[model samples]
Target: MALILHDVTFEMVPTEVRLLTAMTPAGFPSPAQDDMEEPIDLASWLIDHPAASYVMRVSGHSMVGAGVADGDMVVVSRAVEARSGDIVVALVHGDRTMKRLRRRGDRMWLVPEAEGLPAIIVDEDVEIWGVVVALARRYRT
Candidate 1:
């Protein structure tokens, strides 16, 4: 599966959303709390460097195993250095793709999360564009 790249632009005004102080549990139900925290700017919370950060939409199932499903939006940050085991947006022969970065000794590779997909050995033609910092998804649109 291939990924499509898109540039994201942020508005001048930040949109604040109310954040609950209580932590929701995934395994069991917790007591309901009425505590309300300060409003949070999602864009600011997700992006560390606004000038070098971009949001791209996932178009394929290659990263589904990594919790990045199709149609999900990922925040990419160019300010951070790409490290081994980090999910990154890469340009392979000028084509953009999203994959996990792996470093074995001096060799680097781009690995897909899905089965049957071959891992790409990083060479001169491949460029690590940015590292995935955050993921956003909506259950209903």
Candidate 2:
């Protein structure tokens, strides 16, 4: 199976697909009383929420422009709506990548967070697995 966002579809190799599903968020949260500042555990919320969850570690600088760098763990939710210019995870040529989603009319482009990676124009076959919701990175001292 592949990831589909809108009309764009991102296909991955079987190994990558397994990796994507295997790496999950750390915790699942229970519900809390209203008006409380307690946060909802994303892992658990995803059970009822339409989005799928994955915790992926950044391994390149291509997305440093988006504050995602090597060693950063991104919390990606597949259920969120992917709008134009949103950061997303996509598979390009059997490889998974994190990039900004930019749509132009019926055409779309994947903008890399890392400098120098050429912008990729996507066809209908491009799969957009999900929108990135939050990023957790370790700061280097």
Candidate 3:
């Protein structure tokens, strides 16, 4: 299936909570919150460049090693500069794909996290849409 960009605009919801000071352990229960400071807007915290940022639903597992699993909604920012080692949504040969950006001298490549998958060598026509900033996925019940 082809990748689609679903344009989204955020209406700031001032939702804040006391973030726990202690890390919850998987093996056992941990102590309660000792302290937390300031109210934080989760949407603002996640997407710094609000005007140029958007979200998309991921459908592939090629980026699983990068913690971007299938069925996850990834936040992307067009204003955020795309650098080497940054996970980006790009257009390769007219096909939109999500991969890790890698630059070697003057050449660019899109690498997949899966061991058996092959890397995509970017041609002159490639267009980088944006850099992936955050990912959201719901746990199965």
With a 3 Å backbone cut-off (N, CA, C), the pairs that clash in candidate 1 are: none
- Cα error of candidate 3 at position 58, Å: 1.1
lDDT of 3: 0.78
lDDT of 2 at 58: 64
lDDT of 1 at 42: 85
Residue-by-residue lDDT tens digits, candidate 2, 1-141: 122322222222222111123222554343332234444454343233323666666665667677766677666777778888889888787567678999867978998655556778876556887788876655776
Residue lDDT tens for model 1, 1-141? 565656666643688999875655564434575477799988788876888888888887878888898888889999999999999999999989899999977999999898888989999999999999998899996
Instruction: Supply the TM-score for candidate 3.
Output: 0.78
Backbone clash count for every predicted candidate, in the order shown: 0, 10, 0
TM accuracy, model 1: 0.86
lDDT tens string, model 3, 43-134? 77877777788878887666778898778888899987899999999988887888899997898899877787778887877898899988
Weakest lDDT window of 10 consecutive positions for candidate 1: 25-34
lDDT of each: 0.85, 0.63, 0.78
Return whichever of 1 and 2 wins on TM-score: 1
C-alpha RMSD of each candidate structure in angstroms: 2.6, 11.9, 3.8
Query: Model 1, which residues run further than 4 Å from truth?
Result: 24-33
RMSD of 1: 2.6
Error of 2 at 9 (Å): 24
